[model samples]
Target: MQIPLSQPDITQKEIDAVTEVMTSGTLSIGSRILEFEQKVAAICQRRYAVGVSSGTAGLHAAMVAAGIGPGDEVITTPFSFVASANCILYVGAKPVFVDINTKTLNIDTTLVEAAITPRTKAIVAVEAFGHPGGMVEIEQIARRNELILIEDCCEGFGGFAGDRPIGSFGRAGVFGFYPNKQITTGEGGMIVTDDDRFADVCRALRNQGREGMAWLAHQRLGYNYRLSEIQAAIGSVQCDRLEEILENRRRVAQMYMTRLLDNRFLILPTITDDVHMSWFVFVVRLNDLFGPTERDEIIKGLRASGVGSNNYFPPIHLQPYIAGPYGFKEGDFPRCEFVAGRTLALPFYGKMTELQVDHVVAVLNEQLEKVQMVRKPRI
Candidate 1:
């Protein structure tokens, strides 16, 4: 009866795609990878897509192709996975940390401009948990200040803002095909863009800097970050079922909302009126009204009840890796630091059953009662 945090919804279609690749004896890169790139580009409405080794590699390649080098700084939020900041460092540029809007968990666009310096070269914004950031405002700022904008859409594949798709709003957008993401290919990622020259640079950098169409031409520095046709086949197959995947996730999220609708003490997530969510990971925050003790207790109790649960993130700023190096102490980014401590990620996958949702909610309520009893003064 244990509910795992996430599981890929692989189907016969996925197996057949992989079988076709194996049967062809072209297991590396060829037609399948090409088709994957085409399909992803079409999904994002971009002119090109390059399949890379992983999301980290896609981000690193985007930085390199965009000419982010030493002595430069890239402005980004500190509430995401480390790769967002590490990509800047991969190209010898420093990551300038910005705080996030506690609600959306997205970068605070209002604070972006003051962080810009003569050394700042780019803005790397992540669409946290499959929700688009305030891209319109971010884009306006980038254009006025003359900076490269990279959309870290690793968690927001099918998400959009208004009539525009997320990744297409910036100079380049990166996505991951890791198992927990919108789609799965075991291990894969992509870089999408409307600029042909940037796409060519990335393709060259992925292989071995061989701009020459022939395999032997080594024109610039590069790495072996190409995705195998096996993975490409899986990505193509999964891409075909993405709409179903997204719909299932969305439905599960709605169920949780209806079941766990607590107005007084639990801050349930609500998708903003216009922004569409891909529902990568359903999350909730404990309001202060619940008191400080309930947060950790509820998370522990949920796990004990066979309901898989984990914290959203520990704020990249406070992470041990960056804390000392960047001189980030507790109060640096209050919202990010506070949310990191109280937010919990509940189990909400495409295959989770309604009964499991009920069990999870019950466990949470029991924990809240236990914590309240502990805080009550003895009469």
Candidate 2:
């Protein structure tokens, strides 16, 4: 069986919702978008939500709403999807790379305070792999520094940091609805915030700077980042079944954990006591003995065996675009680079079966042994 890396858990309910929207003449900026935004806001425990074309768009809008512009600096981890850092760049601001906590794979809050400079305007904290680790600490640090906090909840839609929902800790938080996420709208996102003014700004930003249904009047420069009615209609249905979707994902995650927890060569995802995770991808790290080369070989072997696998992330700082311009070297963020080198993402989805999970584990174990034997030749 060829187990794919990720799949959307779509049902007839979502199809019916999409069909209803298609039948309706009004497609964009309609009631479906409004309803979807409301549902997302409620889920994040925020007063408002602005639907956008993608999570990247939501983050860019949040950065713009926060007045982050030229000469400003936004601190974020290097061990995340590039969008987290790219949003800072979209506004002509610099993104200061930080290392991640080895355990949670999120930004190391302990080091955040030290990264703050006078030019530091905001902290773009990403809930990496849907784990809300160190978010509370990051919030406290941001408050102390008087910096804006933008929570990248792109992978953390249904998670919590202690008693608070994932989006509530920041001035603005964004959720992505990519196919691989816990819930999907094909390609859409939501920006959530309690700040009324910020919400208005994001809403306008997503709709070509038109304020309050003014279609042609442009107040400021903006992008066409609006989420479509069809996407929102599907999203609304997904939101209605959010609990069921999250529970299904959690169940699949547990299955992986139960099967792989005893493996000596791998380090599984860590969930802190105070935080509730919304599992996005099941990523495991090869032990310190395994380097990027070995990890890549293992991934290759897994794929060769019909088990889907991939390196979850490569350090964003080391990417050619960022590294060359910013003068970032390999050792700039050791912890992040270390973790990025060995991290492996396995096939994960709400509907993934136990047999599939077992097959993936078996393939992974076989690959690990092969790499190990090659590294240490028989004497």
Query: Which numbered prediction scores highest in lDDT against the true structure?
Result: 2
Clashing pairs in 2: none
Task: Give per-residue lDDT, candidate 1, residue 233.
Answer: 94
Candidate 2 per-residue lDDT over residues 11-76, each given as its tens digit: 999999988989999899789999999999898899999999999999999999999999999999
Model 2 misplaced regions, further than 4 Å: none
lDDT scores of the candidates, listed in order: 0.86, 0.92
Off by over 4 Å in 1: 290-294, 377-379
Worst 10 residues of 2 by lDDT: 206-215
TM-score, candidate number 2: 0.98
Kindly give the stretch of ten consecutive residues in candidate 1 with the minimal lDDT sum: 287-296
lDDT of 1 by residue, 1-379 (tens): 6887788878999999999988998998699999999999998999999999899999999999999999999999888888888898788888898888877788898899999999999999998887785777888899999999999999888888877786787799999888988798889999999999999999999998988778888999998889999999999988889899889988888888998786355788757777887788888888765533467777888888887888877788777877888788888888787777778888878888888888877777787777667766632
Report the error of model 1 at residue 126, Å: 0.7
The true-versus-predicted C-alpha distance at residue 349 of model 1, in Å, is 0.7
